[model samples]
Target: MGRRPRQGPPRPPAAPADIQLASDPQPDLEHEQTVEAAAYYDVDLTNRLAERVEFFQCRFKKATLAGSHLAKVRFTDCLVETSDLSNLRAEKGTLERVKLSDCRMTGLAWSDGLISDATFTDCKIDLTNWRFARFDVVTFEDCNLSGADFTDADLRGASFTGCDLSGAQFHNAKMAGTRFRTCELEGVGGIANWEGAIVHPDDLLGLSYVLAGALGIVVRETDR
Candidate 1:
């Protein structure tokens, strides 16, 4: 068995697998609503209002979560495949042991969340708002994370593999134990904050200009 995701607290047991997906959003969702062990395919969760809900061991394939509002929600051991999460607003949520593959997460507002053991593979996560979030042992593989905001976030032990991080913001982000493998760092922000992070030698060459700027050095063409 693989290692478990870094979780803060233990959640309650999930329901049976035969649980049905919610067709309509609950007008007033209360505390600790559990939505686990279910599968939803090609459904629409637009304009939903869910708070403090738990989505455990659930799979959402080809679903649209446009304009959904989920605050302080918990998503553990869930798989979200080929889904449209554009304009989804989630704040202070918990995501552990979740795999979001082939998903469109543009303009997602997921600030101040706890993300661990999560893999965002083959996902379009451009312009996602993850500022002040805590990422522990998460991997972003084969994903387009352009313009994603990780400012002031804790990204220790996170891995970025084969991902396009162009124009991504990393201002003041904790970089200890962070690894970037075959990843694009074109125009990535906050170069001074990436001292402890690991990167390839070729990738470092690509960051020369940024590094020079961070060190207040001018790189001028020397006439031979």
Candidate 2:
């Protein structure tokens, strides 16, 4: 018998209580500092450097973490909205039960990271680096992931819907059971590694073109 069908929609992050807001609304994040049940709005953490910091049950709105080096940081049960995480380097970080919406994450580097039970919606994730990352129950919807790198990543539990993934690189990636729907697969790299991925019929044309290019097959229109 075939493998059991993967579960549907991932679990969302737990809602944080308003009463649990941090005493200092804009608390500084330090190395190994753990913050829970807090809300941060419009806080600028640009170019900050921290290691192994953790955030739980937290909400970040309009917060800017651009160019920050947050290596090995962990975020659990968190919601991030309208945040700018562009060019942030969080290598080997962990993200669990997190949801990010309307965030600008272009050039963000999450390589060697672990992301589980997370959802990214309407986010600009172009040129992001997810190399050597592992994803479980992660969903990306209506996100612009063009030119992103997923080399050596494990994506068996990931799904993309209505996402612009044009020119994305998937070399050496493990994609068994991965799902893609209404995604732009034109110019995607590593077509040979897509053996077990599930793609919507509507996306086959673009995927076929990419596959053909990889196989050195050329197609031409014929006059009727």
| Candidate that scores best on TM-score | 2
Give stretches of model 2 more than 4 Å off.
Answer: 1-6, 17-27, 222-224
RMSD of 1: 4.9
Cα displacement (Å) at residue 145, model 1 = 0.6
181 Cα displacement, candidate 1 (Å): 1.2
Instruction: Give stretches of model 1 more than 4 Å off.
Output: 1-32
TM-score of each model, in listed order:
0.86, 0.93
Q: What are the lDDT figures for the candidates, one per model?
A: 0.81, 0.91
Model 1 C-alpha lDDT per residue in residues 54-110, reported as the tens digit of each score: 887887898887788989888888888999999888899988878888999999988
Prediction 2 TM-score vs. true: 0.93
Residues 31-108 of candidate 2 have per-residue lDDT tens digits of 999988877787777888989999989888998889999999999999999999999999999999999999999999
Model 2 clashing residue pairs (backbone): none
